[model samples]
Target: MGTKTALITGANSGLGLATAKALAQRSFDLVLLCRSDQKGREAQADVQKANPAVTVDYFIADLADLDSVREAAGQITAKYPQLDVLINNAGYTPARLEFVDGIEKSFYASHIGHFVLTNHLLGSLKAAGAGANGPARVISLSSAAYLGGRAARFFRKIDDLSPTFAYCDDKLANLLFARELARQTAGQGVVSYSVHPGAVRTRFGADTPGFLGKVFSLAGPLMRTPEKGAQTSVFLASAPMKSIGERNNGGYFADSAPKNTHNRDINDEKAAWLWEKTMPFV
Candidate 1:
């Protein structure tokens, strides 16, 4: 059989990089997607140095831009006949409101971009699973913050520009997408999961200049390291199908275990609404 392949967004730093390295150690070929060419090259070198026997390549695509995402997906699909795992780990939480395709920046980058990219690569994922040793998986990095309230409270509309609301909305969307994906791809040999990597000492929300930034800064010492934060993602990507539990196909996981989400209202209606509303943007 061919070597397993995993594609990771935001692989240049933080949990994304840590997950890539862990997968490399497992002998999976990697495709690191970064927004910056310089950082992408640096991360590529780091992964290569850590695992010289595995193939490590980097591609540039800013997740905030749908066009960039499509271009990158095109390139990826053209080059790789199959994709074993896709870890949507990139996210954004700006201090002030930002817009992309008229949608909130955090929502666009964290959820919308990955939504489109995953659809574009679904064929590859299915092909991989069909020919691989086991089912292929898609792991999305959501946040425990999503449990604060119902996503509809913050994400009633796609145009909501509040930074905090947008961040929460996207995290909730991540879980919704994963759940819906699993539902749609059932019996297709592809499974999906949304993961909360725990509060990790990463650059998340550090760019924000206000109370949120200060909170992330103060919480730094108390949070998990990037390596520890990546454990759930690596587990979801590499663990046995039975080990992860068939019931977890569309579930949320943290610390390598299934965790309950706060949004009890996340049902087929909400997922379908989100998918339809965000279709034009993608």
Candidate 2:
């Protein structure tokens, strides 16, 4: 087959950048989606410097804005006829409640924005999967934090508006989104996987309030580095289809292995419901 192409969101920093580097080493042409043009260019330069033979391009899009997501997806689909992989790695965790387009900022950017982008590019992904040796992969970056919310009974309802619960709900939405995408596209050669990158030492929660921000910064020394955290994403992206197996097609994984997600509420029904409710925002 021809060379593969992978698009990664938030590819300028942290786990996204790490995954881009790993894919570049494997010779996959990369399209990086970054919010900042300068950072995107710098990241493109860095990846090209590391792998001179690989192709690296960047597209700027702010996930919090649905119009930006739509425009970016349009440009991507117009430019690339085939897309082998998409990693929804960009995330936001605000210290306080903030809304964008009538939805919570973190929830909107992390899950809804990605949901729209994936749907827009579904045609390209399917086309690539049809002609390639394996199915196209959609990897969503969820978190173990969803488990904590489940323990606290936060996911009992799908319409919680609390800022404190925004991040957890968003992660759960990511898992459900991936699973539902897999189910809806079954037998069509598009595969979706949600993953927990495991407490990476990246600047994820730096924007949160005093105690929370301090906690995120203090835990940096004890957490996994971005490279280590990107392992599971890279693994899911590059692994052979037969090796991954049908059982893991819509499953959540961590540390390069399929793992059980904590929330029992993340079924097809909830996934469908969330998708319907969030559609207007996209």
RMSD of each: 2.1, 2.8
Candidate 2 local lDDT, 131-224, one digit each (tens): 8445899999998877644323322333444544677777888888888889888988899999999989987787777555776888889999
Per-residue lDDT of candidate 1, residues 1-282 (tens digit):
116899999999999999999999898999999999999999999988778999998888988888999999999999987899999999888678766555567777888889999988888999888974658899999988776435564334444345665667778889888988898899897999999998899887887766667778999999999999999999999988889999889999998999876677678788777777767765
**TM-score of structure candidate 2:** 0.92
Q: At residue 137, what lDDT does model 2 achieve?
A: 92
**For candidate 1, what is the lDDT?**
0.85
Best by TM-score: 1
Candidate 1 segments whose C-alpha is farther than 4 A from its true place: 153-162
lDDT (CA) per prediction: 0.85, 0.84
